[model samples]
Target chain A: AQSVTQLDSHVSVSEGTPVLLRCNYSSSYSPSLFWYVQHPNKGLQLLLKYTSAATLVKGINGFEAEFKKSETSFHLTKPSAHMSDAAEYFCVVRTNTLTSGTYKYIFGTGTRLKVLA
Target chain B: EPEVTQTPSHQVTQMGQEVILRCVPISNHLYFYWYRQILGQKVEFLVSFYNNEISEKSEIFDDQFSVERPDGSNFTLKIRSTKLEDSAMYFCASSGGRGRPDNEQFFGPGTRLTVL
Candidate 1:
């Protein structure tokens, strides 16, 4: 079974300060992990993905996440938080791919980040 | 940067009425999926479609839910009878890789369905 757990339901950070959103996962095998962001009135956008190749993944908008296997964590981080960075973030894990070229993608409950001025 | 698109950003319907949510996946993507998020809840997977047929579906996807790729560019999800519980934000996504590890699915802006 594969599951995603976002540690914080809501996180508030001061403007220009560092941001950290924690996520953990349980999977039977090495899985593909991703971080996605959904701004108000917008679609879900991929922030970063961790494949087998790299453990530290960089995403758009200066966001990044490092996959730590021993800790079972893929925490999202940004050096400086901007006002526009406020959004709902989701941590996702992809299970084994089926023969039909698809796999089950499990999503976390999400963390709503609030950038405080 | 090709992206997925969905129609009717918001929809309102009476209970028991049928509603069709439309999506146009990326032209090159081979798989399509539907997911929904109730207000303040996590997004749940509804179904995944490939080769014009459903490859996988979650328990929430009962008989009332059906997915179709009527044409090369369009995929649609039809709810036979809308229920008040069906009110949520529905998103469509597509991926281009063939069962590869890095094939990330691109999502649409989503359709907010308000079933009354």
Candidate 2:
């Protein structure tokens, strides 16, 4: 079974400081990993994805994540935390069905980031 | 920028009542999906639609749940009977991105369903 774990339930950082949200995944095969951000009362927005391509993936709003196969991790990070960056972040892995050859998304519990001034 | 959109920001219904949620995916996208998140829970996949039919569905998408494209633009999910446990925030998403459908899925704002 493929699953994702977001290690931190909540993380706080001062504005202009570095932001780090940790995530780990378990899969039998090479898996596709993604990070999504959800603002309060808003939809989930795609931040970035890794599909056996570049290990260091860059996403919108200066967000980026590095896929580490050895660590089984795809942690999200930003050089500077912005007040508007405060939101819930989810780590997701694609789950493939061998019988149907189709797939569904398996999401993590999510990490809530709070940026303070 | 093209994006997915869903209607009925919120719906309140009694148990056993039927409800329909609507979404309009980005124009030209070929794949559609439905997911729901109960308050304080991880988002769970319900079903995926492609080529005018269901390509994949989770265990939660039982016989009571159904999806349809209806026309060229709208994709809808209908729950035959509602349960208190069914109360959740339902989101609609679309992909088929530029190449890999699994690459990225643009999600709609979501409809908050309340079952009484």
Candidate 3:
């Protein structure tokens, strides 16, 4: 089984300040990880994905995450926080086998980000 | 820029009533998925559909739940009898293929079902 744990349930950042949200995952094998953002009353928007090809992944809106195998972590970060960045973020793990035909994804509890202007 | 679309942004139903949530996935996608998030909880996968049949399903997808691709574009999840615990935001998602590195899923806004 695969699972992800987000360290923070809520994080607050001031506008123009750095932002960070921590996540750690457990998988028996190499895994595919992703970060998604959901705004109020809206659907999930893919921020970035780590497909094992890259250790550092860059996402839209100036957000990025580094996949550290030693730490078993994939933490999302932003150079500078924007007021519009306030939303809920989720870290996901895919439990698909290398030779399987089906795929299932597990999502984290989610971290709510608040940006103060 | 194609994306998934779901119908009935919100639905309120009485207990034991049947409810069907509809979605239209991307035109060329071959994999469809249904997931739900209870209030203040993480998103949980319900089922996955491929080739007009169920490819995978979770324990939560019991006998009361069924899925159908009635038409070429429509994917529907039907709950025969609703329970208070069933009330949540259901999201439909689709991917172009299975297990591909770039086969990222696109999601719909979701339908909020309230079982009263």
Candidate 4:
């Protein structure tokens, strides 16, 4: 089984300040983790993914996440928050098994980011 | 870049009425999926289709729910009889290639279904 837990339900940050949104996961096998952002009335956009290649993954809009194996965490961070960064973010876990021949994504409840100017 | 497109951006139907949501995934993609997000809830996976057949489905995808490719370009999801609880935002997504670990799924804007 695979599951993701976004530690924070809501996060508030001032524009120009650093941002941090924590996520943890539980998977029986090697996991493919992803961070996705959804703007209001928009589709889910992939920010970045960790597929065992790099521990520190950089994504669009100056966002990045570090995959920590020992802690089972993949937390998203940005050097500075922008007003446009306000949106709902989801932490997702994809099962890496090959026998399924299908991709199954397990998503977290989500964290709503509020950027203040 | 190409992206998934969904039709009937918003649909309002009475309870027990049938609803069909349409989607046009990326032209070259092979794996297609359906997911739903109820108001203030986590996004839940419904089903996945490939080769004109269902490859996997979640428990939430009950007998009342069905999916069909119908034609070469469009994928459709049908709810035989919707309940008030069925009102939610339904999103269609597609991923290309051999379903590799790096194959990221592209999503549609989603269709808001309001069951009255």
- Candidate 4: which pairs clash? none
List candidate 1 segments past 4 Å from native.
B97-102
Give the Cα error of residue B28 in candidate 1, in Å.
Answer: 0.8
lDDT of 1 by residue, B1-116 (tens): 78899999999999999999999999888888999999999999999888888988999999999999987899999999999999999999998665452378899999999998
Give every prediction's interface RMSD.
2.0, 1.5, 2.1, 1.6
What order do you get sorting by DockQ, best first? Answer: 4, 2, 3, 1
**Which lDDT value does model 2 have at B21?**
98
Report per-prediction Cα RMSD to one decimal: 1.3, 1.6, 1.4, 1.1
Name the top DockQ candidate.
Answer: 4
- Sequence-dependent TM-score of model 1: 0.97
Q: What is the C-alpha lDDT of each candidate?
A: 0.92, 0.93, 0.93, 0.93
For every model in order, the fraction of real contacts preserved is 0.63, 0.65, 0.67, 0.72
Model 2 off-target regions past 4 Å? A98-101, B97-100
Better of 1 and 2 by lDDT: 2
Write candidate 2's Cα lDDT for A14-36 as tens digits: 99999999999999999899999
Question: Per-residue alpha-carbon lDDT of model 3 for B1-116, expressed as tens digits?
Answer: 89899999999999999999999999888889999999999999999888778888999999999999998999999999999999999999998654442377889999999999
Chain B TM-score by candidate, in order shown = 0.95, 0.96, 0.95, 0.95
Off by over 4 Å in 3: A98-100, B98-102
How many clashing pairs does model 3 include? 0
Ranking by TM-score: 4, 1, 3, 2
Using lDDT as the yardstick, the better of models 1 and 4 is 4
- Candidate 3 per-residue C-alpha lDDT over A66-103 given as tens digits, one digit per residue, 9 for 90 to 100: 99999999999999999999999999998865333557
